[model samples]
Target: MQVSNRIAIAWPLATTAMHERVDALRQGGEDVIDLSIAISHFPAPLPVRQAVAAALREPRLPYTAVGGAPELRAALAAKLRGENGIAATPAHVIATNGAKQAVYEALYVMTDPGERVIVLRPHWPAYAATARLLGLETVLVDQPDVIDAAFLATLPAARVLVVNNPHNPTGKVLTAGELAAVRDWLRATGTACLVDESYEKLVFDAVHLSLAACPDWEALGIVTVFSASQSHAMMGWRAGFAVAPQAWVSAMSTLQGPITAAVPALTQVAAAAAFGIGAVSELLADYRVRRDMVVALFAPVAWAAVAAPAAGPYLWCDIRALTFDTQGFAELLLQRYRVALMPGEALGCPGFIRIGFIADDEATLRRGVGAIITLGDSMARAAGGHACSA
Candidate 1:
């Protein structure tokens, strides 16, 4: 049997090694503190869990409408309009297994094989990998200071561009002005965009501007994706939705009908409940406290400098001063320190690492970060004070 060339060349999902090591340590009876993945440590809001339980008892748990459960779509549309300033109706919504699928389906509908897909680095690896799997070419560009003429000149004739705000790994929320510039660039280049706003409520000191909220967003060809995974601590539920132009959404629905059939019936009901319960503010409060805890813990560490993440649940540490190479540092920390972190090499930056702060209790976070501090000191000493930055 032969595998496709796409499968042969694609890089494995970067977190796979982290998960495997964590499991190995647990099996060996070693205490492991994981900060690699961004899953919330908190439980699902009581109301949403109760809703899912109740929904399970109902007998109507069959395949739903291909786009989504109608009520959930309506609820999502209302939330997008009321909170995120994205003017959407149920007619323009398509629910998916998760925000990842929402993004993939949007790409599937809006782009074609052999078309160029532009992604800014450092980025979630899935963005580029998914494009490759779909027979699309990925053009990776260093995230620039501005979408100016020079930056525009470097882009290929791209079909879809991926943007993640309250961005992963770095956690910097894209400001309104930045979004405006992106909108202008998209229009000028005749490109469509898939903006992942999964961390919509997770912004800390900055505001999250949705591309779909841009004036004349439809004309600019933007698709905005939101997920209950982060907002409601429903990662296992795999419930999310996307808002795009009606025609594009219809096309996605048609594709989804044959692909996934529908997102789980009961999960959709729970998602609708999640939107109505209004518990996100409380969850955000917890994450905010945790974020602050991380800042205080790492503030005085000389081997590495920590920037308070402007949004999301991560702390992006510039570890170049500790070690010029991050993957080596991350592996050493995992094996010797029993702490897991995301190396920036996984996200296309080589001198940093991302720590997800919301996935562990304060005591565990303190301990994990303490280990990282120790490892940094050791690595810095090993490097003999020779280090560099990105």
Candidate 2:
């Protein structure tokens, strides 16, 4: 039996990998702590839950329009205007299964087969997998700081550039100036930039600067992807959409129509309510609290420094001082210490690992950090030396 190449492509589901590795370790009766998945174990705010419960009562069980319910899109329009200062309307947005699907649809709709796309490395691995599905050649750019001229200069032939702010693995938030520089390059070269703001609302420090905020960026050929998963903890609800020029909206619409007609109408209603939370700042406060706990634990670990994730709920750590490559080291931790984390290599950061602060329980967070530190100490001891010199 033969399957299409697109379906045959290898996709690294990070959370699944963590679960499998941790499962094997536990089956062997080894106690393990999982710090891999970027999902919040905390409950979706009560108001949001109540909203979803109320939505279930509506006659939204049937399919809605391809772009999504008009009301939800309108609410998102208000959000874009209020939060990011970008003007949008429901007509220009097409809701999909989730941000991942919106991103996949962006790639599918924006490029034809064999077209060139640029994914800045230390990026979500799924970005690469999604490009490969469409048979697109992806040129990767690796950087440790804000996107620069050299980075933008590398993708000379790219038709689209996928950028994730408060980046998945790295948790680096580009300022307006940094994004502007890239936008200038895109305008000069006529390259399309698909900015993924999946974790936009999970910010811990500063407000997320939307690439779509600057008027020039929107005109320089840009598309934006957002999901309710992180912000509203609506992962299971599959609430995501794309905001783009009305002219190109048809491409996404045509692509998403046959796949996911729209994000659930009920999800739309629930999300609308969630997005209006006046107390939503608590989410950021909680993420920061957990992030700080992890940072404090790793501070004395030696040979490692937290990247100080300004916006997202994680710390993109530089750990090359301990491991040759993160994957092997991470696997060792899973097998030996039973602690699972996402190896940085998957994000194109070989010497690093991405630690997500999804657990809201302070005691659980501290315990998880302790397990991680113990694992690191063991790994260091096995190396015949300390990772951090005292």
Cα lDDT of model 1 by residue, 45-73, tens digit:
88888888887887777778999877888
Model 2 gets an lDDT of 0.76
TM-score, candidate number 2: 0.91
Q: Say which candidate scores most in lDDT.
A: 1
**Residues 95-136, candidate 2, lDDT per residue (tens digit)?**
777788888888887889899998888787778888887899
Query: Which regions of candidate 2 are displaced past 4 Å?
Result: 20-31, 216-218, 387-390
Cα-based RMSD of candidate 2: 2.5
**What shift in Å separates residue 8 of candidate 1 from its native position after superposition?**
2.3
Q: What is the lDDT of residue 212 in candidate 1?
A: 85
TM-score of each: 0.93, 0.91
